[model samples]
Target: MALPKEYVNQMRELLGEEAEDFLASYAEPKKTAIRLNGLKIESTGFGEKEAVDKPSAGQSFVAGRDPVPWAAGAYYTDKTERPGKHPYYYAGLYYIQEPSAMLPAELLDPQPGQRVLDLCAAPGGKSTQLAAKLRGTGLLVTNDLATERTKALAKNIERAGIGCAVVTNESPAKLAAAFGATFDRVLVDAPCSGEGMFRKDEDMVRQWDADAPARYAAMQDEIMLEAAKMVAPGGRLAYSTCTFSPVENEGTIARFLAAHPDFEIVATESPAAWGFAPGRPEWLTPEEAAALGPDRTARLADTIRLWPHRVRGEGHFAALLERAAPSGMAVSGASPESEPAGAAAAESRKAGGKTGGASFKDPKPGKRTTAVRRGAEAAGRGRSKGFDDRTGGESDTIARYEAFLRESLPGWKPPGTIRIKGDHVYAVSEPAGSMQGLRLVREGWLLGLSTRHRFEPSQALAMGLKPHQAALSLQLAGESEDAIRYLKGETLQPEPAKVTGLNGEPADKRGWTLVCLDGCPLGWGRWDGATLKNELLPGWRQV
Candidate 1:
């Protein structure tokens, strides 16, 4: 690989005597790894008591390997392993991600039931990690400004069986204005000149230019300001990038700290333990450092750097910043009254039962209802698709949905505000109408489609459900022909005896079924006494 002279010169000044090792490290192979989806395994008690350390299904593939040090349930794999082709991968049991990229979400450490946001989330690796930490207990508003990019973002969230996430395609400024200081944790995985990924993706190297760092730094600073607005008082914000540029890393944090006095860089866990180095304040231009002042620039060392030469992964930089709160004001979530528009009354009326299964009550006429009607119209489908624009109102829709829940899930009660938009149904974790005008990719967990008198469950609904949650389920082994055929969208004639009830006894075998692979829920199926019809989403079918 021919290194760019300007980039080489910059690295030499940045690394000093370590430049040779940094340059030599590019020749090494890229690292490969996967994180087991606890949302899938733990909910079902699939393999072992502790699925994080010992994933029984993929043990043979990743056994005897030390897990990624900083990330739990993440295991390094050889490039030839091809875990993506396995049935479990289709089952949404794990996510494939590069090692260093996992650190930012871990640093943010969002807890269950706290509102979190991923500002630049797309193709959602970090967003899913945050969802796993939330454990379906909180709202995760994952957004990407790129409209086209949101397709992949929403797909990944659905594939992971994450019920609490709301995917959006909107600008950082719009999101900040809408949410206010509402989130407990916010992540800005800012875009930059892809210097860190050059070894893995040759296109990044081809796209690089000497002026990339300063250009990207300006955008990163702007993104950080918006991200700061969404974080609640006393909340934390985590900034990360896959570049080694000092202007984009320490300089960005220094500029932010100097501008926002309420925020400070908190030291992370020991940097040596993770093979991470301290942030380089010396790399900044003297003029830049002087403008930032001595104290602010000196605090930049609390940030982290994961050099390719020093770690087993690509180049990455991360910093954790906290917003100080006034006395008695460190709330984790914003009250409904504080939400934009008349969302407070919408929240009061939209309060729902477990599994979002309660009766639906429409909010009073005005902006909130108008927003709901507009969203529903935007998502409306014609009657040829089996949908009906009945004037029976939200109550009737909830009635049909409840019928399906009674027959299929039995007594399961998941949390979230239920939303009935045209023919589609969703269980949004955020308060109703809170995200009204944003360009929403998904309001929340898409329960299914409501067609005429029937409520059809979605592929997303299946991924999040446990074996026992469904009244009937079909369990298949990972290597079984039945599993592969099921993933391939092929109808099957499994013996009626193979079908089991919620109690594991011979079931009726004549209705909706939760399909599973080694006890992990895959998707939904409809089983008759003689044959099982495939209900897997066409887009997710195995090719």
Candidate 2:
């Protein structure tokens, strides 16, 4: 794989003394990593039954052998193993990720019970991490301008069993208009020139050019400005890129700070711990950014730079920022004297700021808002065209669905509002006030769909369930050949002796069955007395 000459020339100039090492690092094999679902950790509760941390401890996904220094429950998977092909992959156990790509979410550091947003979440790697950090307590809105791409985002979020997030397919401006200053922390993993992707994908090298950086930098400028608006006054926004172009990195950060001094670059957990380099402010020349002043250089230095030569993974850049105004940390309906928890509240306390003191407060669930979005409001209050929010659907859909939840998931309780749109049913994490205008592809958890006679659980719902919650469950070993067949949507015919009723007595009776590998669901199946019919979604079938 040859590096582009102009790109090489540009990097040579930027790297100064380290250009040779930078180029040489590409010859080495790229590293592979996976992050276990922290929501599955022992005490974290997304389900009635806790997901065990280690396979030896209980029925859960196996943690990788070596831990990545910067992320908890994240590890460097063996290069020899096909981690993506493993049965646990279908079980929402872990996410395959590029090691350095994990940095932005870590720096953003979302906490439990705070309102958060991922401004450009797609393919949902970072969004899943943010969801795990939220621990199913706070509201997480994952939005992207590309409407089609959010499907992938929604699927991954579902596979991970992230219940707190509301996935939207709206542009940054519309999102800001609908949710101004409501997010406690917002992440803008801005779209970039893909120079950092050259290592893993040679195609990106073929497409590189001198002009692409400037084009993307201009795009980032608009998105960051809008994203900044969504962050609560006391909230923080994390801007990151997978590219090394100063135009998209320091130059963009410098320009934004110039336009909004009310927001300042702040320190994130030290990047040095993972061999990450610091941002080069000098890389941004006056010609590149007219508004950039002297102080911009010093402030931009706070941003993190992960270079291939300096780190074990592909290159990346990040800048953590905080807004100056005071904002509340408590959820709406909590007392004025109530205190907030997590990073946002801690930072507010450190700054001696008051919560809800400046324009931002907890959002009330299930209401309409025009002035500003409350940080506490759960997503999906938008009224879609086909569904009746009043009746929960065409005919008693909410009632039938709620009854299904009661029967299917014993002891299951609605975390927040449950709304139905068309045939789709959503379990909202926060109050979804009037989202009449925004293009919301998904809000809260996609519980399933409502039909005339009964409600069917989504694959997402099955993935989110505890093994025991299902009426019928089959926990196969991770390496079991049946596990492989199960992922392929193949039927399993266990010995008649082992075939027992869902209640663990005699053989017979069943509807939907939850298939699992070590107690985590692979997908849903049906029991027709003789065979366990695989209901795994076609797209998820193992090739």
Candidate 3:
């Protein structure tokens, strides 16, 4: 690949003597990688084990190697291995991601209990990183424009074991309406022309042109505006892109600052205190350019601008902006009021479970109801029994179902606390706690929990004293050795097992048992009073 004259000139201005060499190297962007989920495995520990474990999922790790520097717990791969298919990938131990792509989340520094947003999240690389940063608390709203891509993003979030995120498919305007000035931090890792990715994805270069950055900048500006509105006053917003064009980098920031005086360009220091350079005044608007003299510009020097030639990662730009307090706007860290009635009801249905067709009784009138058939349909004609007899038939079925529900579950409402989307419902309770407990519904699965605690796990508090609790330690009749290994976290072939209580006795026990390694709960397993079944731990199951 040949460098454009503009790029060559820019490189010369940026790197002087090494510009030519940098251009030559740019023809093939080096592969930079990061471990999947750092919260599960530290980079240093993972790298040390990678040599013997060959962590690239059987992708060779070059026998003797050091860690990649751009991101912690990251390494460079020679494109000789398929890291994506490795067992660790399945376990969510680490995510294979580009080195530079990891920067925005790092810069945003999302912490526990902070409400954050990933405006253009899709296929969720950055959003997953942000989720890990949350450490499983607070809300993370990850939105994307494409429906198909949003599904992929949601799956990655699930595989990563992220619990408090709400993924939405909507435009920036819709999101702003639903959640205005709500987030503690907002990230606009907006869509942009693929300049930095060109080296890795050659097709990008074929489609690139000078005008692409300008076009993308226009979209980015709108996204940044929406981002500003959603960010709480005194909160922060980090805008970034993978392209090197000034039009999409400093130029975009400059334009935004010009339009929104309430946001200030906050300087950020490096993690190691190496420091950063300020945005170039030449790229700023005339007014902004004059607001800072050479000396004041020097004071604003910690804004980041990472170049491929200068940094060990891909070409990327990021700037952190702090929202200034708007007059009379409360900055008390309150969340926005509940969503509108009909939208709330729609969201409730999407959350999964049976909606009673009655709207909420709140004075706000934020919920609406719609009715569909209530019970299982007739079999052969592929139609429900109520189809031929809508009025009396369906009504009778619903009444009977409601009566049965009332008798069996006195205080329980239908498992309506979950919002089902596609194959899964974001439940306020674990599906297992519901009356149907583990039964599959059209919504895929039903999860139950205490209404007060939402769906947070209580560690099977009841199991702590169950008569068969000890049965969790039972061994398979023919595979005692294998059972021991399984308890020790070793990989074992599937086999049948006989279940017995801790005292070596058996009863009519049929339910899930919690397996522990030296008293530390490993995960849950099922017992049919005879055979034991395993449900992989959220983080320990891959092996």
* Clash counts for the predictions, in order: 2, 8, 25
Q: Quick one: best lDDT, which candidate?
A: 1
lDDT (Cα, 0-100) at 92 in candidate 1 = 76
Which candidate has the highest TM-score of all? 1
Find the 10 residues in a row with the least total lDDT in model 3: 375-384
lDDT of each: 0.74, 0.70, 0.51
Please, what are the lDDT tens digits per residue for candidate 1 over residues 466-525? 788899888888779999999898998888888999889989747999888888877878
Ranking by lDDT: 1, 2, 3
lDDT of 3 by residue, 56-75 (tens): 32224223333443344445
Stronger candidate by lDDT (1 vs 2): 1
lDDT score of residue 46 within candidate 3: 33
Give the alpha carbon lDDT tens digit for every residue of 297-382 in model 2: 67787788988887778889988887776333333322222233243333322212211111111122111112222232112222
RMSD versus native structure for model 1: 9.5
List TM-scores for all candidates, in order.
0.87, 0.82, 0.63
Clashing pairs in 2: 328-355, 328-356, 365-431, 366-431, 378-430, 378-431, 381-432, 382-435
Task: Judge candidate 2 against the unseen true structure and give its global Cα lDDT, from 0 to 1.
Answer: 0.70
